[model samples]
Target: MRRVTVQYFDGCPNWKVLDERLRDLAGEHDLAIDHRRVETPEEAERVGFRGSPTLLIDDVDPFATGDEPVGLACRVYLTDDGPQGSPTVEQLRAVLA
Candidate 1:
C-alpha cells in the first residue's frame, strides 16, 4: 500500500478538505493516510513542511514547486479548477493511482 502523509498545522482549515478527499480516495487506491500536525516553525523546518495541507506521497510532495515559504500557512493548489485551498479529488486520485 502507498503511504500518504498529510502534514498540516491546526490553524489552516484547508487540511480538512484534503483529509476528506484522501478518505474518499482511500478505498479506490491501495493506500494509507497518516496525519501529522505540525506545531512549531522549528518542526516545520525540520520536516521540510512547505505549508498546511501539504500532501507527502511516500515522503515527497508531488505538488510542491520547491519555492514555497515554510511555516504555518494556507497552501494553495493550482488545479485545472484554478487555485484552490486543496487539490481536487481527481488530482489526488491520479497521484494515488
Candidate 2:
C-alpha cells in the first residue's frame, strides 16, 4: 500500500483545501492518507517539512526541491495556471496518478 501523508502546521488555511481534495482522491483511489501536524521547527526539519500542506508519498516529498528553506510557513505550488497557495485538483491528480 502507498503511504500518503499530508503535513501541515496549525492555522494554515490551505491545508483544509488540500485535505478535502485528498479525501476525494482517496475515495476514488481507495488509498489511505495520513494527516501529520508539524508543530515545531525542529520537528519540521527532522521530518523534512518544507512548508504547510506538504504532501509526502511514501515519506518522500514529491513536490519539494533540494533548496527550499524549511519552517512553519505557507507553501506555494507551481502549476500551469500559476503559483497558487494550494495545488489544483488536476495537478494533484497527476501526482497521485
Candidate 3:
C-alpha cells in the first residue's frame, strides 16, 4: 500500500482539488490518504511543507523539485494542460501507479 499525505493550510482551496483526485484514485492504487493541516510557520518549517496542497508520498514529495521554499502559500503544478491548481487525474495515476 502507498501512503499519501496531503499537507495544506486552510486558506488555500487547491487542496480540495487534489483531495478529489486522490479519492478517485485511492481504491485502485491501494493508497492510504492522510490529511495534515499545517497551521503555523513553525509547524510548516518543521514538516518541510513546501506549500499548501503539497503531496507527500511515502514521506517523499515526488512532485517537488527541491527548489520550492517552505511556506504557507498556494502551490501550482506544471501540468501537461498547463499550470494548474492541482495535478490532473492522469498525472496522479502516473504517480500512484
Best by lDDT: 3
For residue 84, what is the lDDT in candidate 3? 91
lDDT of each: 0.90, 0.85, 0.91
Q: What is the lDDT of residue 83 in candidate 1?
A: 95
- lDDT by residue for model 3 (1-97), tens: 8899999999999999999999989989988999999999999889899998999898988899989899898999999889998888998988887
Candidate 1 on 1-97: residue-level lDDT in tens?
Answer: 8899999999999999999999988888877899999999999999888898999998889898888998878889999979999999988877777
Which sections of candidate 1 miss by over 4 Å?
A: none
After aligning candidate 1 to the native by TM-score, how far in Å is the CA of 34 from where it should be?
0.6
Ranking by TM-score: 3, 1, 2
lDDT of candidate 2 over 1-97, digit per residue (tens): 5668889999688989888988888876666888999999999889778898898888888888787789899999888898887778887788778
TM-score of 1: 0.94
> Looking at model 1, how many pairs of residues clash?
0
What candidate 3 gets wrong by more than 4 Å, as runs, is none
TM-score of decoy 3: 0.95
Candidate 1 lDDT score at position 50: 89
Q: Write down the TM-score of every candidate.
A: 0.94, 0.90, 0.95
lDDT of 3: 0.91
Error of 2 at 31 (Å): 1.5
RMSD of each: 0.9, 1.3, 0.8
